[model samples]
Target: MITISVTGMTCGCCVNKVRDKVGALPGVTGVDVDLADGKVTIAGITPERTALADAVAAAGFHLAD
Candidate 1:
């Protein structure tokens, strides 16, 4: 799993948005979000960091560097 920190997630809807965005990417088999910790865990072959960031951004969230 690849773990990344994100911001602007505060509730179930936020989690769902992140999950759907990240999960839609190629090679992403799974997506798990930790609202309290602001973490997103992705399973399967890792995609490019930029692509991941873009997906997160499209969902209205920012990925912490």
Candidate 2:
């Protein structure tokens, strides 16, 4: 499992968007979004950090540092 802190996720819809986008990645098998904490946990094979960050950005959110 890889954990990423995401910003601008303020509601259920945001969570859903993140989940749907990240969860669709080739190696991703699971995704958990915490709107209250602005965290997204993903389970999958090792994924490129740049790809992950880009995906989050494309979905209209910032991948927190």
Candidate 3:
């Protein structure tokens, strides 16, 4: 599992959106969003950070270091 910080998510819908967006990426096995912590945890087989970042960006969020 890998954890990434994400910004611009303000509600449950935002969390779900982030979750869905990241969950659908290739090799992604699971996704968990922590709104209060502003973080997302992804579980998968060798998922790339750049792809995850792109997916989050496409969803209108920023993935931070």
- The alpha-carbon root-mean-square deviation between model 2 and the true structure, to one decimal in Å, is 0.8
Model 2 steric clash pairs = none
Residue pairs in clash, model 1: none
Clashes of each: 0, 0, 0
Instruction: Put down candidate 3 lDDT per residue, 1-65, tens digits, no spaces.
Output: 88889999999999999999899998889998999999999888746778888899888899876
What are the runs in model 3 whose C-alpha is more than 4 Å off? none
Candidate number that wins on TM-score, 1 or 2: 1
Ranking by lDDT: 1, 3, 2
lDDT of 2: 0.87
Please give the TM-score that candidate 3 achieves against the real structure.
0.91
Highest TM-score: give the candidate number: 1
Best by lDDT: 1
- Tell me the spans in candidate 1 whose CA falls farther than 4 Å from its real position: none
Return the lDDT, model 3, position 48: 77
| TM-score (C-alpha, index-matched) for candidate 2 | 0.93
Model 3: how far is 37 from its true place, Å?
0.4
